[model samples]
Target: MHNSHIFDKTVLREYDIRGVINQTLNQNDAYVLGQLLGLIVLDKHGTKVCVGFDGRESSPFLCEKLSDGFTSVGIDVINIGCVPTPLLYFSSFFFNADAGVVVTGSHNPSKYNGFKISLNNKPFFGEDIKNLGIISKNYSYVKKSGNKIYKNISNEYIQRILKDFNGNKKLRVVWDPANGSGGKIISDLVKFLPGEHYVINSDIDGTFPNHHPDPTKNENLKQIIIEIQEKKADFGFAFDGDGDRLVVVDSNGNALLGDQLLLILAESVLEDHPGGTIIADVKSSQILFDKIQILGGIPIMYKTGHSNIKKKIHETGAVLAGEMSGHVFFADKYYGFDDAIYAATRFLSIFSSKTQNLTEIISRLPKVFNTPEIRFFCNDSEKFEVISNIRSRLISSEYKVNDIDGLRVTTPSGWWLLRASNTEPALVARCEADTLEHLNQMVSILSYELSLNNIKLPISF
Candidate 1:
């Protein structure tokens, strides 16, 4: 361990360990991470660990070394092989493992790679991840394990989803895995899905030779939309790099935002479990909260991180929860981790139900014009201060401001939110109104406020 490079604090983020390969994280980092994580699991709980990785080129190499480190620590390792983050999460419960770790860069660029970890089915994040950094600095050797096992979890996970619905109707689905880990498992999973699936960019390429894997951006879904229209498919689905999040397009190639999809899923879940707790992050529209209330469900607004959202869900025992960024969690019929594949399956199930088409379902919701997430570049240290200044200004004004995560100020016409992104060095702003002019007006007001504080508005409407 003396030759191993020290772990950087920047790479040990609040939610996960992520960094550029070779630059911040490499094989030695992976090995040390494995040892510390294995020790954490063994010391805190027991030795059963489930491991999976994404389609990144460095993922396999890291997974191999990480497994060796875990085995060296006297822990039993279950290698679920290359799969999505959600698949790894699902395997955690399916295999009854004590902990799990998914090697993925998530929606980051091809050069990035990281781990999303869990202990006893809960997110091992924040101080937990930071604690690993502390352990790494001390760097003590652990006794070698004579007990290590490699088991396959695909069959169990696949069976759980398949058992939900029999192959009844053939659905024409245009799926773009975006050269992600989902590409490797989606084809096989859909084989029993009773659907004529037309998959594009399904090859697992770490270079991302097609397009970026983030489905939230409209530009990334352009190819999938075109394929859906050309193939006359019922709908098209796109997954982020690790497949924990999803973006949907209808039969006519209309893109459906995550909140819209949540509305649809909420309706279905509320039907089965009325008055159940439904949670959404602050980034989501007020329309979701209103809809949840009207449908006899309790709506709880929470913070904006996936791990934060999951922890809230477990604490409140919320049956369903979602984020505007396409991360949807369902505790109603499945485990509560965000799963894009399972969400797509649920969407398909709804499409085949007695309800209306996706377009029709969306049309039934109240119309509100909303700006997509507007990110403005800012120094990480100064971003929070900028938000604080804006908050102080809003407090003196004649607007109702909610400072749950950032600043969500409400007016008669609409609402505007200004918050710092947890993952990136940018301030995220969004405005929504019943009319386009009102939305624009809100944006202008936000810009003026930022300008007054000597903080240049980094985004334009």
Candidate 2:
């Protein structure tokens, strides 16, 4: 193929391709990506590719160009229309396609868009993503007539999700999709669930006018918490823009962090699979890992990215895994991919099976003080060097450090972490301890470490 197209370097992320719409990404880039992906599939002796997009305004046009590129290469395209990222993943299996792609920006602002790719049911990321850039500049293209088929798998996806429901009691539940792509499907799904359901922001609005689509932020979760309180519901579930992340709120209108939610899911999963392996990201609270060990399951702390956790789960044969950023994966009965809708269903099933409420179950866990992920400004060029400096100093001082993804130092009272953000010009930090005073001490220690490198902690404990 003589169609020489170059992608902006910033768009080629570690896990997926993402960029500001029109500024750094456009129709031509999407078209070229489809062509390259189609070529890769054919090279692997595959014939069909599944394509889906989110509710972003730019998605449909990009999806159109992407599908054209796929068909131009003699690779049949199974278009799943506008749906969540998980549904795109499900389509790959349902249609027995060789490759899958989704046009989504995930939890980012509306002005951004990107693609997530998969080959043969495994995540196509890291070096796989970097290779696309090289291949786009130079590659032989196949010219043939391949077909594009439009299929709506909403009914099938909803049916499969509900099939896992084995609850013994009916409960009032609230769902907040935050006007994301999952709104339409979740609205349809609640109709079949056995409960009094309340769905807010059910419209699929690309603007995300209600609030940011990220459920991890407390400000974004306020609406759902309010809805839960007003409706007097058992609990509420909030999903990110592409429906790949989840946040749960108890009846008391208190939001649960991702690690806390993961512990809840782990209890049910370990009950079914004794001594199973459960993976949590490095940034997750140590309490979560300890709880998993106490539940008679093996806990493995891995990297922070969703793709990293997913890869680790595949390698370790783990049944469940999650990150602190609300990306939860369940491979016990379903595919091992992050799906907020499926996670919500599983949580509901678990909740309805027990007599204890979410608060009660969570209250049984050991108490600890921790800080939210704190990201401070640091030049992208210098962030890694700063981390390296800190790590070297910590190691020289005989600090117990885990450098899997970044530097996680084991303190006497608890632990503290310092890592560079993968997608931004910043450094991330967190500290945890058994008491408020210990937590403050940990924060001071982290601050002192940063100060050694001419940096200061943005917030005080």
Candidate 3:
């Protein structure tokens, strides 16, 4: 009663289905996934679905095959070709589609590609995604073919993103899309927004000619930093590959960490929606949580991953949520989905009435020495176990720990987090303290713990 087609295990990740082009993933796999998704939608009594793809060379072909499977399953496919993942998500909400999917690699390397999906206006991931693969292995199709329609929501989407523009300061700024999918929309976004805007690497080049699109990494933000300072702009915004995440660089070219960005945005968001819950991933600094409470808003620490944060935001009615990796979701005046372009606009709106610039706002926050998220190689099979053992031992050692997503240990110096990455086979850790010496002391503790577990320390850290 069912047909089974096995897919590469590695491609079905905790967040989304991703893999190297033509290796772990291929056109046939896309078709199978597309068909599986269509079947699931129909079973849920859904008819229409929105589909989009990024700028990768393989995207066009993948999108075509994926659509074919959907159409064959009698699911009306509204194809919004070549857009950022956020825009795809927006389409689901804007057009009120029952489901949606975007073929994208996100911030991964050029060779990588993946799909981000939404069902019934919420993130469809984790077990939902794995279940799709499982059903794919046993699915039997019915003879039905749905119609395909082409729609371009680019202009409408950009207008919606800028509709609530509260910016009046007309500050000078630089925006870098890193030659990723956000380029097209960013180019149009600046045109209508109130600002003296400048942009670099805004071409939708999948090869990522300038640098990898992940602004969290310093190397990716280098060119934008150089341009902003050289042009004497007020600030800079760098977008990740699919444009959902944003990295802000001050006028002096110092990029604000993700928590700092959220902290800054939270202050403003709380002004209108006071006492609103603000969610930050466990990797965020303690200062962010403390500051959120001081600002009269509830601070919730949750697991990492955009989908996880989005789900938590929906469940708790949070006004805002952000991760250390630059994913910021706002529910105040917009959908509770991460959008770098919208976040950028909101960040700039803060400048509308303020005399002080970007850096000045951050200058007031208490300073802490912290390490950027440091990841070490661990076999996928063992990474989760490693974190579990670390958590058990830490608790047995009488150390206070928060096990929301992973084991976050509290120390007199500061706090340290050890979590298995949901997206990769690695354990991610971050440490922070009032001073550099204390910070290293925390690192030493982390190293000692890893050594005790027989995991060799990564020399780079």
Candidate 4:
């Protein structure tokens, strides 16, 4: 109980701790996390801690080991059993816990798993995450025994989400949890709704039997599209692996990216609270910002990642925030964390209470050409330096560059963005233009800049 355990340095990231489970992460790492995270809570004047885990195959083993570490350190632990990350966050408030931790891989492949920690009800990330590695590697925990108990908040969580479902219209819909942790939650949720509903892959399978459980990839959503079209459903929704992210499929089976969904959600949030500030990640389309402004809500673009957006919302008092990867946060009437299940319910409520022309509404937005986020290989150590060098080059050429998150250049054609991803060993770039030719040109500029750093842009993402 008094020996330090050094973790795989690569697992500690800016947003959350993640890595390929057995390869870079194992039971010892999980135990170290519990001890270190529990110490953080105690140091911050906290006592009780809530713990939850996803349906990943390795999640249960990690969860048990982590709980042992917490109890070994005299941190009272409340085990919520298998649940989505959002529900774990909710447990913090419902049980008045000092901190919360959830074992989830998010949208990564099944081989991946990690922990997301929340201290004092706020996200414990950035320097705090890195410090976990630093501190755990240096010293060990004191030997102390604590208590452990189990609590089930599933019924309460389901009912609380349904309380706000006072929609005017009832439309048939298809729900897909992608066989992740949210499967049971969705299965329970649809029964109480007014609309006729059909759910696919509702079994909580950590192996992700149906598709990879990632809705962002178009292929994973194809079956849901077919289900929606054949069932004559109004709209379809899908969740990422851990149920913290969501993707929407229109009636025509067209998938609307997160940027488009944020614009639509703005219509609902701004109608009730006009002139409120709304936040989106830097990679969002310019149209989204303009639309939010037009809707009478101020739009602020911050760095990508749910943790960053959550912190930005708390600091700026923004009513809503979302990322292109489908992590939507709502601070208006609920906790300001990325809860895909909650976001789906809110969107349904808005769909029924608000206008019915969902397709037409999105189509009416001003048309602009853009390329999907293009990710290219880059070393973790050099990606930031590459971006820095690229920024210097852009500045020397007098190009308008916004380096808020990474390097976003405003050009006559449109805006091109290049930023190092927080989660992976790669650089992400996006381009937007009024025309296809201009879009290509902007991408070419990004490519040329990367070439200068001896990095070649991938052919496509």
Best prediction by TM-score: 2
Q: Answer with 1 or 4, whichever has the higher TM-score.
A: 4
Q: Rank candidates by TM-score, best first.
A: 2, 3, 4, 1
- 37-89: candidate 1 lDDT, tens digit per residue: 78777787686888889888999999888888788787788888888898899
What does candidate 1 score on TM? 0.95
Q: Which candidate number has the best lDDT?
A: 2
Alpha carbon lDDT of each predicted model: 0.85, 0.92, 0.89, 0.89
TM-score of each: 0.95, 0.98, 0.97, 0.97
Instruction: Give the Cα error of residue 191 in candidate 3, in Å.
Output: 0.7
Displacement of the residue 223 alpha carbon in candidate 4, Å: 0.9
Tens digit per residue, CA lDDT, model 4, 1-461: 46677788789998889999889999999988888887877788777899999989999999999999888888999999999889999999899999999999987888999999988789888998888877886766688988999999999999878876778687888999998899999999988887789999999888888898889889999999999999999899999988999999989999898999999998889988899899999999999998999999999989998889989999999999999999999898888988999999998888787655578777888899998988877888999999999887778675788889999898876999999988789999999999989988987888898889998888855
Off by over 4 Å in 1: 1-5, 166-169
Candidate 1 clash pair list = none
| True-vs-predicted CA distance for residue 256, candidate 4, Å | 0.5
Tens digit of lDDT per residue, candidate 2, span 1-461? 56777899999998999999999999999989989998888989999999999999999999999999999999999999999999999999999999999999988999999999989989999899998888787677758879999999999999989888888678999999989999999999999888899999989998999999998888998899888988999999999999999999999988888899999999999999999999998899998998899999999999899888888988999999998888999999989999999999999999888889998887888899998899899998999999899888888675689999788998778899999998889999999999999998989999998999899899743
Over all chains combined, what TM-score does candidate 2 have? 0.98
RMSD of 4: 1.4
Residue 386, candidate 2: C-alpha displacement in angstroms: 1.4
| Model 3 spans with C-alpha error above 4 angstroms | 396-398
